[model samples]
Target: MRLKETEPEEIKLNMTAMIDIVFQLLVFFIMTFKVVAMEGDFNIRMPLASQNQEESMDEDFPTIIYVQLAAGTNGNINSIIVDDDTTFSDTDMYSKLTQLVESKIAAEGNPEDSKETEVEFDIARELKYSYTVKAIEAVSGKVVDGQIKKLIQKIKFKDSTSF
Candidate 1:
């Protein structure tokens, strides 16, 4: 009697195609990654006027406060003098900022009638993140309800410069 014929083994799957598809998907993801930057900057386009109304007080304002930020040697912001002060530090900066805002609010009396307060940081071109962040933090703390904003009035350093 003839022996029963043995059935052939099923063909195995070829993982090469699967691997290629996976590689293609990986490459697609790498190429499609989004580039988002956190640094904020102000737009520099001044609107043109019809030249009818006369401009007044463009150069000097009496009620403006100047805050200067400088990178200290100790690296923890040792000196952050507001307007003019001999000695100051990061810890005292917030208190001073709060006091200033409080004084301004007190002087204004009515919250609605009070003029919008602006804080300026005359920062150096080579200023570091440590100094800038502290200034921002101080201003934020001083302004209740997060109204205090650090508007980028001037960027001293060029775009090429990295801080």
Candidate 2:
């Protein structure tokens, strides 16, 4: 007996939906991607290692402001000293340092130019990290109304062993 043969079914894959989804994903990622500014983009000026003898002897040397932090027995900040004369406790460091920096800026007669002043931080090795950050913020100054006011743009970190 002869049996009738049936035709084989054809199987096909639909790639249109997959291609559309892939394109959508690519568009979404492209739209959401962010370009970040690099650390060198701020145009920060670093101190030069050498200078002319005449320029070094000039009386208009950059005003150096010293911030010394003394650590207590427990590794906390015991006292804060500014220019070796003014002193502030841990709680009053912010206000006092801000006032001192503001006064220094005012004394310069040119608040717009922050290059004339230099800040040096003499931090102790045992001091807490938070204290060091607070000290830096104090010397950096803050915005007062709408304008951006800076005390000193040149900041130097001395050797911790010097403290």
Candidate 3:
């Protein structure tokens, strides 16, 4: 007996289920999505050209104070030099620093004058971090009679390569 061969039928794919699954996934993601603010957004005001020019022409601008910290063999602060004139050792470093900073800005006679003054630190690369911090604290402020006295607000570090 001879067997008859049957032709193969075309397979049809149901797209409704696939479309539903895609729609479900899209809806889930949309429902779970959250809106967030961008980081580091700052509100800065730009000055006009005339104002900038006027400010630049002002001769009463404060001066820059240079403080150099030298390190010893043990990474400790060996000496503190201010403006190539005054030097304070580890024994009385902080007190002398505070006094020097106070005296420098004292001519202005206004506490706000300290804000106009800028301090640039030229610290040794090998100096101990603690000493660096202490030096910063010394010029930053002082506590007098149970009250905090604000000092120079503008502080910056000089490049180590320049030392």
Question: What is the clash count for each candidate, in the order shown?
Answer: 0, 0, 0
Each candidate structure's TM-score, on Cα atoms with residue i matched to residue i, is 0.45, 0.62, 0.60
| Comparison by lDDT, 2 against 3, better one | 3
Q: Indicate the worst ten consecutive residues by lDDT in candidate 3.
A: 40-49
Report the C-alpha lDDT of model 2 over 1-163, residue by residue, as the tens digit: 9999989889899999999999999999999999998652212444444443355577477788888888998789888888999998857877789888888888878877667787888888989887887777777767789865666676777742211
Please list the Cα RMSD from the true structure of every candidate, rounded to 1 decimal place.
Answer: 8.4, 8.5, 12.9
Q: Give the runs in model 2 whose Cα sits over 4 Å from its true position.
A: 1-59, 159-163
- TM-score attained by model 2: 0.62
Please name the candidate that would achieve the greatest lDDT relative to the true structure.
Answer: 3
User: lDDT of each prediction vs. the true structure?
Assistant: 0.52, 0.76, 0.81
Look at candidate 2 and give me any clashing residue pairs.
none
Error of 1 at 80 (Å): 2.2
User: In angstroms, how far off is 120's CA in candidate 3?
Assistant: 0.3
